[model samples]
Target: MGLFPRYKRAARVAGAAILAALLAGCSGLGSKAPPPTYELMAVQSFPRGVGPIRGQLIVAEPSALALLDSDRIMVRLANGQTEQLANAQWEDRLPKLLQARIIQSFENGRRLRAVGKPGDRLVADYQLLIDVRAFQISADSNTADIEIAAKIVGDRSGRIRAARVFKVSVQTDSTEGPAAVAALNDAFNRAVVQLVLWTTRVI
Candidate 1:
């Protein structure tokens, strides 16, 4: 009878341990949550009066807007440390981002017949080729510096129509990454506004 009592107590303890383990397993099975997702922001502006530049193709780097490289050196937090932004998506890659910004600025200017990528079959009168050298927010990040070298070539004549390098800096107090992007965008906007005005006169 004494040995029977000890055996019963041992069985009870083992049963309790198994029940606790099962409950823990069930909790674990139900604990997972979905990962966060981000939707890219579409290029903003009106398409009204906007069409392919009469006879030109605007080609931009496809993956520039990605955290990935975009030929243009983007300003990043410098200390050999990186922090991922929560769930924000950008409109285009580096070159494409810059191209779209340029396109939109021109759209706002209400100039040009058509402005688009380079693959169309139409005979372009002028082609604007761009190489973005640096678009960076400085160490203080209070200002954004943008430098771009571009050439406008007459398609049929194959002559360098208008070639100019643009460098512009816009002041801002924003220290955030998105704010830095916005400042850079603003600088680009002003520079393109000037370039388009000049181009409209020349062409």
Candidate 2:
């Protein structure tokens, strides 16, 4: 009878150990690793131009829809619904990220006498107003599309001097996050190149 009680206790201990191991395994299986983060590439140097635009130019932060404003990488589905990529995210909020890149693009051109933001306190000749219409990857076709509307306004007059829309699309080689990001970068670079060229010409 004494041995029987010891055996029962031993059996209970073994059962508890087995249950604990099973629970740990289940927990490990349920948890998933987070996806990788990616950043937008800056256009370091633009093609040399005829001359720098006179006076300071302020590049305002681009306005975007709520969906495009986030750091999550967006994808447009065939069904017309927008979704985010599973394991990838942008380095920063989309608008702020694009604003920095645009500023960098202008700096790379070296064709602006002075480039700055709104708070720079520089006497501005013109302000670049940007509206981001679209910036997303297409899940169906595995492509990236970027569209931006740019307007140059005389700072003092507050009148729009020149306005144009820029759009570019680049096809991705694969459906993976890296491929989509690469395509997005290519499309964004193309748009920036065109935007800089046009701005320099008009302003």
Which candidate has the top score in lDDT? 2
How would you encode candidate 2's per-residue C-alpha lDDT over 75-147 as one tens digit per residue?
8999999889778999899999998988888888887788888898878899999999999998787789999
Model 2 scores worst on lDDT over the 10 consecutive residues at 47-56
Q: What is the lDDT of candidate 2?
A: 0.89
Error of 2 at 85 (Å): 1.1
Q: Estimate each model's TM-score.
A: 0.59, 0.82
How would you encode candidate 1's per-residue C-alpha lDDT over 1-203 as one tens digit per residue?
A: 68999999999999999999999999999986632332222234433434434334453333222444433234545563333432333443456666655666655555566665566664667777776665666654467776777777777777887878778999867645566566766786666766675665556
- The local lDDT score (0 to 100) that residue 198 gets in candidate 2 is 89
lDDT, each prediction: 0.59, 0.89
lDDT of 1 at 116: 58
